[model samples]
Target: MLITIENRNYGSFKYKNSTAYVHYRNSVVAEVPIEGELVPARGKINMTTSVDLKAETMISNPNFMADVTSGSLNMTSTASLHGKVSLLKIFKFPATAFSMCNISFFILTKSIDSKCTSKIKL
Candidate 1:
């Protein structure tokens, strides 16, 4: 499966070395170092990047659904399922405050992977 994540005003978090991992079935499939994090209010991180996730190997069952095992983003840990909006919330970011962050989600069955690019603004 393939997934994409992105948003606006995503260059304002105070993380010098940001790292994130996306896992499925208790196995880490993708890992990336986001340059920075985005914070709207107090201690909230914003995920405003076009992160594309694809499955490396294809399963025999074409209707197989991916189960997100765990994900560590910007030092925060979470357990989010595939195709769930709460996955974004697991980052400890307030969805109500940064509504204009422009987060988009896309999924395509092919490879199991994820992509994240951090843009920090000081």
Candidate 2:
């Protein structure tokens, strides 16, 4: 996924603290935090990250056949952002924070002809 930020305000905005996390079935799969940056007015930036679907341990368990046969996966993400406004390039106001959360579900399927083979030599 790509996170795009655009600064449309008059003054430059400083991003103090920013973090993102991905969760699957209430389990955290990936997380990242970015360094602070000053964004000039009219400037834009993009951040990118991805989660690993193969990390689902239940998929490999025979007892969890229901989950695999269902052929669906649910995931969620939470993002936090803290920002401060710069006054005259010297003084700064108190930092304000915001958070966003999202949930998504998708179908999973396997190819019929796909196969994995291993070779060993002694």
Candidate 3:
């Protein structure tokens, strides 16, 4: 599965050196680092990356597993993210966000159908 994490800095403090992890079924499907990067206040960290997730890990049926890439898998899954938010590049705090995306993968379309709405805990 290809996972992309976009973190938004809503507060006035700058966020830096954060890492994003995509969790599905209590397993980490994707991990991306926000190293040496900065998200200005009221700005956002945009990252595009891909991770290889085996079909067997997600699907138990052997007959349908082989056709995942052939546009046979049309489904939606909920994913959560965990990362660090650094203040002024000094103090770091843990941040958690939940993104709800409607996974609609087709044979001819490439579109990101996820939207994240989060409340960072201090």
lDDT of each: 0.32, 0.55, 0.50
After superposition, which runs of candidate 2 have C-alpha atoms over 4 Å from their true positions?
Answer: 7-11, 49-71, 87-91, 108-122
lDDT of 1 by residue, 26-119 (tens): 4444454444333432244434433344356222223333322122211111221112122234443222211111121233323323333433
Off by over 4 Å in 3: 1-36, 62-95, 98-100, 108-112
Q: What TM-scores do the predictions have?
A: 0.30, 0.54, 0.46
RMSD of 1: 13.3
Per-residue lDDT over 64-106 for candidate 2, one digit per residue giving the tens place of the 0 to 100 score: 4655457644455565556776657887665543434454343
Candidate of highest TM-score:
2
Q: 1 or 2: which has the higher lDDT?
A: 2
Q: Of the candidates shown, which would achieve the greatest lDDT relative to the real structure? A: 2
Q: What is the C-alpha local distance difference test score of candidate 1?
A: 0.32
Worst 10 residues of 1 by lDDT: 95-104
